[model samples]
Target: MTSRRPLPPPLELPKPGFGRRTPPALFQPIMGLFGLGLGWRAAAGAFGVTPAIGDLILGATSILFLYTFAAYLAKPLRRPATFMEDLRVLPGRAGLSAASLCLMLFAVVLAPYASGLATGLTLLAFAVHVGLVVAITLAILRGPEEGRVVTPVFHLSYVGFIIGGLAANALGYPEIARWLLWSMLLPAGLIWGASARQLLTRVPPAPLRPLLAIHLAPASLFTMVAAGAGLQAPAYAFSALAAAILIALVVSARWLVTAGFSPLWGAFTFPLAAFASALVTLSQGQGAMSGIGGIALVAATLVVPWVAYRVFKLWPGGKLAAKTNAAEA
Candidate 1:
């Protein structure tokens, strides 16, 4: 709501039977698990933490993705627009895009088993994601004035290509990944600047503050991508930036969570895991950065799964669809 209107008050807990169907936002937890798994895997490589721990998380993430994907897929049978319903809203667009991005991540997960399948899924996810970006752009141009508002979630809409690039790299297509990831720098920087200006001037309500955690994801993701690409200068530069953002978030943690455990807290998972993964990569098992990475890894280990649990708890009940639209409307 920081875009053009006043922020709403904190969310009151929904009573029983809030809603029956889950929105694409369900992908948030899945995104969290993917981040955590990748972070753990990075930690194992850098810090000699047991690889099995990362493997276990990845294993569980695959199963969870299947279960949740099936559940969400079934929604179209009940209401066809459910496929694109969430995309029509502000926050939900991020979830839908995350769902698309997770498809790419899941594709990476499948690479060890079926390289061909993984490659196709990566392409398909990117195609869907591009379509989403185009659709959103056309929608914004085609009609409703309110849809013009840009929330922090827009990061997933345009800047999300960074994930596609990461998946492409993981899938053994570095050239493709390079083009996709590096090309995103412009959009990412622009979005970050615009979002920061909006937040600084307006300061969102408590319920929405959790979304600020999102800003952390871009820097960390960029750092990991840069480090993995062997671009040390930019990697360290982004690492420094990520550390600053992490410190700010930590210092303001109390204020950020003033709404205290609403569904919105799902916002915390990715940035935490992303930074852990970034630090682990940047540290490469040495120096003060490594120590910081260890701390971040521990925090991600503790928090990401808890977030998955909390998000799923909200899945079965709550007027999520209703409240989501009204949150910034």
Candidate 2:
């Protein structure tokens, strides 16, 4: 009998370039800024301050949304394994949250210019957002005990729901919005409490210290969501709490920045934008606070582009992940 020849092992392709290494979560800060800028511009129009600025910011938001959406769509084709890998981990899973936020932001931006298109986009985004949130929540619940590290970024998953609720309100679905908002309250509180406990117990690694700024995001985002839903009492209360958290974060800015220029710095961008947006919402007609909100909005606008530029420069070269790993080591 002739001996059967063994088949060769399957070929393993080399990892794709920096582009493939780019996480969907990387777009979170960029989209957050675009959303904040769009909101501020709308506020400006409402106040009769600079209606032209609204159009300008809207154009910018459109450009960013298109670019980011294209990149995310291409990601699966470029690296099929990334999707499954991201699903396997807590931190990587936050990418879905970022994707949901980006979709909602797109819906918001599209609303004024194209009502039918905006409604269609909002419906699509809402469906996707709900699916992702439920999936991520289940993963966490069924995950191993060690997988439940309560880092600031983990809160992004819950933040996604909050943003979706706001988007629902914008789409004129107050009941749905209210349901979404209330549903997230317990999860958000648990995450915040766990994170706060972790912080009190142990200093986070240097690479992760930058994410401490993320602690401010939930309160800031909730304030805006509450205001959007016309819960004035809770909205104002959350606004005060958000301001306090912002001040505390600012006081520790030196310690936070001492980590310096890691990709993790992206953690700082979205939270600041959330705070500024919340302030703008609170300042609707309040004189001095209005001036303060305008200033905060301008500063956030400038800072976001700088952060985006840094992320882009490092991301394309694959330095962001490399630097983060080296620091952790």
Candidate 3:
């Protein structure tokens, strides 16, 4: 019998350029800090703290990354040959690009409405948002196709961004804001629900499966915000939307135990959940005092440290098997 030849092992590739390679730990902290900044901003705004520092920090960090990411997209102008050809390469990441656009657009509209430092920051934030959105969308449209499974998760990121903006606005224009909130929430809720179901049923591989699993936290947080916002928007529209967001958060929090957190991934949830809490709470108020979201403000503030501790435990390079197919795929 002829001897069989062995196939080559899979190639391990770096993301592309020196700029893409920030030390994972450092990046995690930076991302987490931004998340914390966002959460604090939500709490302060909900409680009627003027000169909203949390809002400023959140806007600043957001604008910085938005601009930086946007700059990355422009590289193709120099190296036309390096352009991405497949959108599926990173899957859910593309969804995030789409979500960022939603944020940038909202910021664009919000800038004109907000006062003080927020005005200038909001304008810059909008520009950055626009740039990042365009770049990521183009990247996904051009990137490879295999990793597209994660695409839904990326879209979910928009849910978090929008929720933050909504909380900041705090029923700014009850009818218009409510419409915008529901517009994004309905599709997001359906898509996330369906996606989570599929992932669970299929029993996807590690890394990704777990990554997708933790996504529920952020998803739940977004739903909470949506429901809270809806209830505030108009009592008539409250029942359905409120139920959806509330149910999702409750069910997902339970799932969080088995799935656990990933510092890298879990970082997304803290601020999001906090913002949701603040919004929902703030919505509970009536008339002038509506700014004070009460108990929700307190609970949401606690979530930051709680999520932070859990996140540190699950961060990459700890006991968990960091090298699952998802990170590579």
Candidate 4:
């Protein structure tokens, strides 16, 4: 009998060009936070508080935005089909929502300096975000629960809607903004209540534990938006609630850390940034709160860069993608 040759290893196919090697949408909040950091610092300078730092951050923000926007442009070109496929999934869909909000927030942050251009961009961003919110909401309501899991990312959909409204206010569309703002309360309330119940009742899998940080988002965002809209009592209430949630999360830091590094860790960045932004906004003229805002700003300043570094380091090598795939498996 002739000896049979061992079968050659299965041929490995090259990755498709259109889809993200990692998730493109994951970069949304990172870029947004960078914009916010610079925007806040610039605002401080415009107010005569830290001209040098503001100038430095503004320069950095411009450079960073060019880099990120270039990368954003490349995603669809690389894998148009894969990009579309991602949007069909829950987390991927949420990422799209976050992307629109990122644009909205970035525009809002820059509106003071670039009033005309920023206002136009903000309106465009708001329209896109609201459209996505409605589409995603309807899809979720109508679609069967096949692969859907109630993770914190789902909150991004409604969060984008709320942020859009806030951005509209910043762009001087007060009536439209007020309507969007009031519309948010019922949906936001329902989402927060449901998410809280889910988290308390069931422990999220290891891959998703990092999403616990998202619990801080709604409260923090509401605080900022309420303060911006002159709703002082609601702003204070949300601020207190945000602080409580933040404290609880900090207390459980060990558990979250044990989940290890995944792209999901990016979830931690924007919420903290939002909380810091809220504090800064609320502290505008209050002496005692200004110190707290300063401290929060410093923390956000450090945290965002570190997280961005970690994400980039992992992303280029496919390390985060591998971990995420394994966790999902």
Candidate number achieving the greatest lDDT relative to the actual structure? 1
- Candidate 4: what lDDT? 0.66
TM-score between model 1 and native? 0.87
Question: Model 2: number of clashes?
Answer: 0
Which of 3 and 4 is the better model by lDDT? 4
Model 4 poorest ten-residue lDDT run = 320-329
lDDT of 1 at 18: 21
RMSD of each: 8.6, 6.5, 8.4, 3.9
Winner on lDDT between 1 and 2 is 1
Expressed as tens digits, the lDDT of each residue in 260-280 for candidate 2 is 776667777778877877777
Ranking by TM-score: 1, 2, 4, 3
Best by TM-score, which number? 1
Clash count, one per candidate? 0, 0, 14, 5
Candidate 1 residue pairs in clash (backbone atoms < 3 Å):
none
Tens digit of lDDT per residue, candidate 4, span 210-234? 7778778777777777777777898
Off by over 4 Å in 2: 1-19, 87-91, 134-145, 321-329
**What TM-score does candidate 2 reach?**
0.83
Per-model TM values vs. the true structure: 0.87, 0.83, 0.51, 0.82
Candidate 4 colliding pairs, count: 5
By lDDT, highest first, what's the ranking?
1, 2, 4, 3
The 10-residue segment of model 1 with minimum total lDDT is 320-329
lDDT of 2 at 138: 72
Cα lDDT for residue 219, candidate 2: 83
